[model samples]
Each structure stands twice: as C-alpha cells, then as structure tokens.
Target: MRKQHIKSHPVASLYVENQSWLRGWLYRKVGCTHLAADLVQDTFERLLKRESYGDVEKSGAYLKTTARNLVIDHWRRKALEAAYMEALHIQGEAYHPSPEEQHMHLDLLNRIDQVVQRLPVQTRQVFLRVQLEGWGYAKVAESLGISVSTVKRHLKAALLECCFYCE
Candidate 1:
C-alpha cells in the first residue's frame, strides 16, 4: 500500500517563492542564465510530478539540492555525449551504428549512468577511476589512499550492481 501524501508545501507556493532564487542559484553553478531557467523549470516539473513535497521542513534547502543534482546530470550527459561522438569519430562514418542502434546504445548508457550515480560515494569514485580512467586496482587504491582490497571490494560492488541490470 502506498503511503498517503499531503502537500505541506504546495508546489505553486514553492515555485512562486523559489523560482528566482533557484534560477540564480543554478546560474551560479552552471554560469548560463538560459540553462539555469530551463533547469528551474525542470526542477519544478519534478516537484509537480511528485505526489507531494510531503513534510519538507526546509523547502529551500531541498530545492537547492534538487537543482544542484540537475546541474550535475546536465554536465554528465554533456560529457557522455561528447565521449560518444568522439568514439564515433574514431570509428568513422562507414563503421557507424544505425540510428536505431545508436539510440539503443544511448539509452543503455543513460541507464548505466543512473546505476553508477546511485552507488555509494566511495564505491562510485572507485568505479570511475578504474573503469573510466583505466586505473588499475592498485593505482586507484593508492590514489584514494585505501587498501587494494578495499578498492577491489568497491569495484566488485559496482560490477554487481551493473550486472544485475544486464541480461
């Protein structure tokens, strides 16, 4: 059974009170007013889709966190697209996947990114260094100041999470 939701802070009230501040807040981090405004709209749309803001005691803080996350997501997506384009460039047009395959690959990448983002902070860090940066376990452990065993543990956890989503 779903827990009943009550809108202690109605989304309109929250939007009216927060949009300008949130936009500025996002702009500071993103350095683009248009992008900030777009993120602000997306942020509120997020709240709108929720059953409720529920019992949020500090709505501004919550909004800031949410907005910050959106900015991070925006950057991550940009980086991912750049990398995909770079890979395609390396492969050349003749080797390119069909549009359908390209879309499927992007969707999978997004889903895997979401999984990585959901990982515990330390685990995510370890996973990125090893997988994205091509760092070995020893190198990641040394750089992170953790034991090789600990690095292996984090990688194992990350791989298990990814594999769970795989066929």
Candidate 2:
C-alpha cells in the first residue's frame, strides 16, 4: 500500500507493538544499532506492501524471517560492491580517469571495435589473438591452423585499418 494507507494498516499496529523488539533482535543479529534500526524500518516498509499478513499465524516469526532476508541481501550487496572496489584498486592510476580522458578513451575503443567488426572473420580473429590478447604471431597461427605468413598479412591489414582511423 501507499504511505497514507500505511498509517491505517493492520501492519501499522503490528509495527507499533513490535518495533522495539524487532529492532533489538536485529541489533543482536547484525551487531549494530544503526543498521538494525534501518533494517527494522525496511522490514516494516516491506510489511506495509504485503497483500496478506492476516493468514500469518506468528507475526513475530514472519517479521524475523523478512528482516533476516533483508540482512542477508544487505551483506551480499556490500560484498559485491567491495569486490568491485577492490578490482578498481588493483587497477591503480587507471581507476580514476579524468572525464575528458575517459570520453576520449571510450571513443577510441569504440572506433577500434567498429574497425575490428568490419574486418574479415579470420583477420579479426588473428588481430584479436595477437594484438588484444598479447599472443605471439606463431602461437596464433598454430592455434588457427594457418601459416605464420597468413597471420602476419591479416595483422598488417588490421593495423593499417586501425591506423587509417588514428590519423
């Protein structure tokens, strides 16, 4: 239901009755009063939107289950964000590109991608393996079952096309 409807909701009465208990339970689970308070609020907000709590025989159990799920979701989101930040930290100076530099870099990458897409399939594969993936020409040729000279020819064509855009 909407915010206005929440004031008159049966869940509102439930919230008023059990809010302190719920918050204390959350605090014990999460070990932080501030986060527990926030989760209690979130739990009540979720309860307000439920179509039926009338069938819920044990309201406290239902509230605890919902709050527990919220806590789990909160932890998962925190872990994922931490992993992303850690990856950025590992990139060091590249993590914080200036807006203009970022724009230019993205434009260059897009142009390069477009050029690669226009190449013949074998040429694109050879170029990606040798240039983008840092594979040796000999290794690429071996992997593709082509002669080294054919690999060089495709890479030269790809580089020339890339240079045409660069100029």
Candidate 3:
C-alpha cells in the first residue's frame, strides 16, 4: 500500500482555525445564534468566489465588519416585515365592523321606520313614496295627483316631524 501526502491551502487552514472564534463573536454581537452561524458560513462561501479582496491585511476585521453589516440588513428587513404585519392586522380589523356598531345602525333604521309610521297618512305616504321608494318630486306629485309644490311641502313637514320624533 502506498501513502500519499496532501498539501493544505493557507486560506482553508485560516478558515478552520478562526471559525469557532468567529461564530462566538458573531453570536455575541448579533444576539442571535442562528444568524451568526449563517453569516459565518456565508462569509466563507463568499471568500471562495471573491477575487477583489486582494491579500487583505486584516482578514479578521474584514469578517467582523461584514458580519455586522449583514446583521444590520437582517434587522432592517425584520422591522419592515413587522410593520407590514401590523398594517394588515389593522386593515383586517376594519374589514369586519364591530357587532355593537352593526346593532346601533339597525337600531337607527328601526327608529326612523317607527317615526315614519307615526306620521299622518298623507305625510307617511308622501315620505315613503319620495324617500323610501326613491321617486323624484314630479313622479311623486303625479302618483299622488298633487302639484310639485304640494309634494315639496309634505316632504318638508315629514322631515321636520321625523327630526322632532327622533330627538
């Protein structure tokens, strides 16, 4: 059996020696174990492909500074996502009106109905025909066989009565 000797690359040796220290430093600085591990792995991966680092004088400082910038970017993205979620939560809350608000709206409509019922027959008819049925003044006047002025007078009186009763 023949034994073969392999040469170790200087860059790979330095990476192995410093990885543990780098991981610990990154965890303390970023306050996140998982992110620290990820950044350290990414830095080494980038070192393999990066051609412009050009025999860096202080590789440790370069790694630490790069890790810090990565952490800052991560925090910025987290903040933006948090704000987006808060906006969505507010919009979802608004999409469904509160039960109390729905009840209040129903109560107001019922009160209006009761007030219209209490009016005189002609006034109730005029109010319902014009307001509830959405008929124009001329159409209501023709249907009731009254002049437009008479229809307007009835509507005004009905509105006043409604306001008085509602209060």
Candidate 4:
C-alpha cells in the first residue's frame, strides 16, 4: 500500500506557534508536565474540530480559552473518576462486578461525562446538585439564586442532553 501524504491543517500553524506557551500555562494550572502536554494536544484537537476559529485577530485568545476549558474538563473527569472509585470501594468486596461489566460501567460513565461537559454551566451544576449530590430542586435553586422553575428547566435540558448522548 502506498502511504498517502496528509495535508497539514491550518491549526497546525497555530499549534506550532503556541504549543509551548499553552503547555506552560497548563502546567502552571495543573502542576504536571505529562498532563499539561496531553492537555495541549487535546486543546489543538478541539480547535481542529470547531466549525470556525472566529476572528483571526483573537485566535490566541481563542486558543487560550479552549486550553482553559480542556483543563477544567480534565479536572472534572478526574473528580468523577475519584468519586466512582470511592463509591466502588464503599460497596465492599461483596459487590464484585465482572471485569467486562466494570469496563462497560466505566465506558458509560465516560460517555455521561462527555455529555455533561457539553452542557451549559448552569444546567450542569443544577443536574449535578440534584442527581449526584442528592439535593432537591428547591435547594439547588436557593443555592444558585435561581427560581425552582429555572432549576427544573436546567435539569430538563440536562436530561435531554443525556438522552441525546445515549442515542
């Protein structure tokens, strides 16, 4: 088979220009060289998939924003995984899942996490408060300084997003 030459994307230039700076910023935020490198790669990958880079004048700002979101996502996933592991630990040895089942559960959790990350911030917070933390809608609204109806709306949006992910 002949190897095909792949054209470099426009984002390639952006990556070449900003990779080091972005990685350094991420390293300062995350305090891990390896994780920062991974996040830099993810940031560019996300940029490549975006429909438009928006204003060329603000490309650097866009890149930084994307990288910052990636860092937040990394932390959120880490926290979710930690919570999952803690739950499993609390279940004790009596609740052993087969390896395959465990893998499936983790995969499902990752899918759920991806869906949650795509949600609007307020909706995500409302969903997490009501579902994960077992808070009532009223409590979430009170804490978030929103009305109960607004909380319900956010939860509905979040659930719809989850349903879309499952499909």
Report, for every candidate in turn, its global Cα lDDT versus the true structure. Answer: 0.85, 0.83, 0.74, 0.85
For candidate 1, what's the RMSD?
5.2
- As a whole number from 0 to 100, the lDDT of residue 159 in candidate 4 is 93
Best of the candidates, TM-score: 4
| Per-residue lDDT of model 4, residues 1-167, tens digit only | 22222225566667778899989999999999999999898888887788876673347888788889888877887887788778889999979788788778777788888998789899999999999999998899999999999999999999998988876
Instruction: Please provide, for model 1 over 67-147, each residue's C-alpha lDDT reduced to its tens digit, 9 standing for 90 to 100.
Output: 888998999988887888789999997789988998788777877898999999999999999999999989899898999
Q: Considering summed lDDT, which 10 consecutive residues are worst modelled in model 2?
A: 76-85
What lDDT tens digits, residue by residue, belong to model 2 across residues 9-83?
677778888889989999988899999999999998887687777744346888989999889867765665566
TM-score against native, each model: 0.68, 0.52, 0.46, 0.70
Residue pairs with colliding backbones in model 1 are none
Q: Local error of candidate 2 at 23, Å?
A: 0.5
**Per-residue lDDT value at 44 in model 3:** 71
Ranking, lDDT, top scorer first:
1, 4, 2, 3
For residue 160, give model 1's deviation from the true position in Å. Answer: 1.9
- Please identify model 1 stretches exceeding 4 Å from their true place: 1-9, 24-34, 49-58, 133-153, 165-167
Instruction: Tell me the TM-score of model 3.
Output: 0.46
Order of candidates by TM-score, top first? 4, 1, 2, 3
Count residue pairs with overlapping backbones in model 3. Answer: 0
RMSD for each of the candidates: 5.2, 13.0, 25.5, 4.1
